[model samples]
Target: MKNLSSNVTERTERRKGEEEQENTEERERLENNRFEDQDETTERARCEWDFHLRTVVSSATAASDALGVIEFGPSGELLATGGIARKIRIYRFSSLVAAASDADGGGGDVALLDHASAYDYYICTPAKLSSLRWRPGAGGRIIGSGDYDGVVTEYDLERRTPVFERDEHGGRRVWSVDYSHWEGCSVMAASGSDDGTMQMWDPRCDGGECVATVRPSATKTSSVCCVEFNPFGGPLVAVGCADRKAYGYDVRKLSDPVLILDGHQKTVTYVRFLDDRTMVSSGTDGCLKLWNIDDARAVRTYKGHVNNRSFVGLSVWRKGGLLGCGSENNQVFVYDKRWGEPIWVRGFEPTGESGCERGFVSSVCWRQVGEEDECTLVAGGSDGALQVFVGTRKPS
Candidate 1:
């Protein structure tokens, strides 16, 4: 009877050992699988340089002239493009349909299968249009246009006529016109001209008189290539000049510049504020400069893109933390907005010289989609069409 009991105990012990080994092996297998899943997820969220060509719109203008500027509507429902052809074209969002409408009018549920679609209409300008800006809260219907004849016209698109016209530059070409977009931003439009002056005009005035003007020092009387109000909600405005210099002026004090930032070797084409204290300027010198408003000099410079003929403005998409610009060769180069490091480059090349002549990319803007890890970049081309690129943002 004792021997039988000992055999039963031995059997029980062997069975318990086998069960423990099985449990350990199962746990090990689960841990290995968990690690594999973690790695796969990390790989999926990583940022990839997979910018896809969305659509191509050729001969966007009837005149076949160079398209120099493109701006997104305040609500992203429309696009406004203008250029040397003296025409302002408006395009409605193509994805908004009965089948695509969301509760918030966002059309988020729609699938954009044919991404390069836009229905276009145009309005003629009196002179070669140099710049076009949409008024705030006009739903992209009201446009303020500046021309080479130093004329500034505010037009109501729905009305199909000019609200007012101003010749503040006085026989000089109005190189740039931009809205302040602040508390009373649209109340007055800022115009920079080849007449070596920057003037503010109130379109509502009966005569379209210049209410204010920014006068730089005796040397800065050179043609003002571009002028933009400080977007950080202030009275400061930065104006780029043909003499390879940029000056920041307080709107309250037009007699002198608050500070001057000079670093480019050639003409300064565009200047804009990334923040109240930080700004970026691009020039024909094939470089982009970052300047601190507190200092009189630029902190850093980015290069490798050329700009000789037309102004290729620097665009900063703060949400995506990106900075990029176009070249005369039609190439678009992107960089890290924070550190100014090159990321990727792309350009459109058709058959030959006929396309190349109009292929120059003069300006670019980045538009971010709603709450999505994606953005659409549009470049104004000399070919009369806008080059569109869609990019996906990778998880950091």
Candidate 2:
């Protein structure tokens, strides 16, 4: 009788454990389904956006054609463009809109060709410009640029002259330059170069020498193609390199990278911080990877743009959680952060002209938005064409 009672108790306990396990499995399945539903809703919203071309501007001279980069000022009041023409063109955002409005309801196919009246002023650089960045909290008075001459220069837009210049890459071509506000006040800058190193600079350091330098890896002979400081305010900095990987490091500790994102089959051309804990990296392997630093792996991969080689630009609109990049097919692609597919694709030519076999969209940027219903996108073509697009969501 005692043996029978013990057996009965054991059976009861096992049955209860089995029931709890079944319940847990059911909960997991339901939670996964719930997430799938939410993703579907977000994707539907992304598909409902409509973007239209607002303005078109092209190089004025044949000698200085082929734009490489385009950037908007911190306040979105000014636009700066640079390229193989070795000239930095500055245009007032209001002026571009006024010109567009005067054309045809601000949505004409009219192309402004080297129109002197369209641009406020232009600066001639020593070499082809590769990248442009506007200084943070400077009221659009200062802008920095990287050039093929292997120099990083900061220009005072108010005076139209370079206020600071650094030539430490040994003429190996400075591919990217970015600024960071450290300790809430100290302004620091960084540049990535073909020299396979990213150097940090602080103007207050007295002699203009870079304060620190970080390499991608000790064994890899890869060039540092792009560098980005965390826009959300932190010591975290990331660099994309020719070794087909992106490395994330803390500015306070440069001895080793805290995270390594390694899925690209080709060179990683660009890196942009999506938030404090996540980032997006673009590779010539024809895909964009969304990485979670804590996990030390890519959370998602975004593909649709035709990028196999060349530095097609990558820009993120944090407010909208949208990623914008140029395609080798002379088109612009926009992707929602939650989806792998592109939400929109538009050709650089507004009139649907088909002579783009030799040209591609080399640079793209989304205007930073705040409390606005509409957003602006600017893209640059290899042939020195600039197109501005305005995107808005359709009323549901």
Candidate 3:
């Protein structure tokens, strides 16, 4: 009886040990399966986000010339675009599509809408519009535009006609226009001409006269390509010149540029102030250079595009800490301010139509709504098409 009892006990102990081992193996298998599933989910999300990084909407073909500049309304409800054909078109945010996935938590799904006909915001026929900018703080009810005829026109949102028209530069083409946030009617604009000079204009005056003009003293003679006003206000402007150099000027005393930036081997096409002391410039030399205006030094140089392909447009998203650039190569690149490599490259797809490759991208802007943390990137192509991309932080 004792030997039978012992055998029974021994068998029971062996069965319990086996059961524990099986449970341990099963738990490990489940853990492994969970890890694999997580990796797959990550990869799939990445692929989807990448797909969204490309072109989202192709603006209507009937808008006439290649689109040159794009701007978003203060509420993100409207997108304004300017083209070489002397026309300005406005697209509503309601037409855009919100991406489905939540990858960045930066904001809600990216806003990418299908191609729809522009709302024909305002038409400046015979003007040859060069740039468009919506006044900040005003509910997108006021717009300012610069034209090749050296004219700056301010249009009220409700009415289709210009409330103010000023030929501040004696009919020299106006290259860029920017309004001040502190003062509504106060505006600072720049004009670049074949004569190799940059003139600043203030439209608030009774006649909207030229406030100041800057020219190369003796050694530098280059046509100004673009100009931008400082976001923090005061008498500061950044200018890009064809002479392959950028100059910073104090509108208070424009006798000479406060600082001269030298880095681009070709013409500097665009200049934007990221903040009070830091500015960014893109050039036909196929390089994007960041400068510290206070110290008057080039802090970093970004090189990716080959050859001097007319890299003309640049903008910085103050909220996102990202910079966007458009080139004549039919491509747009996004770069993180801290990193040297581009976060992503977009707009390379063929339009299935001829002459699309020659379509130079003129401008890019970021539109945000309410308290959202993220913004959508809107670009204007030379073919008079507006494209939107809805992703963040992609490998170049």
Give the whole-model CA lDDT for all candidates, comma-separated: 0.72, 0.84, 0.68
How many Å off is the CA of 161 in candidate 1?
1.9
Which has the higher TM-score value, candidate number 1 or candidate number 2?
A: 2
Clashes of each: 0, 1, 3
TM-score of each: 0.78, 0.87, 0.75
Candidate achieving the largest lDDT: 2
* Model 3 bad stretches (over 4 Å): 1-56, 59-64, 98-120, 136-139, 182-195, 216-221, 306-311, 368-373, 392-396
- Per-residue alpha-carbon lDDT of model 3 for 288-333, expressed as tens digits? 8889987889888876654365434787876656678876777877
Cα RMSD, each candidate? 13.6, 3.6, 14.1
lDDT of 3 at 114: 33
Clashing pairs in model 1? none
Candidate 2 lDDT, tens digit per residue, 124-194? 78889999998887888888999998988888887888888888888988999998855743488889999
Model 2, position 305, has a per-residue lDDT of 93
Candidate with the larger TM-score of 2 and 3: 2
Best-to-worst TM-score order: 2, 1, 3
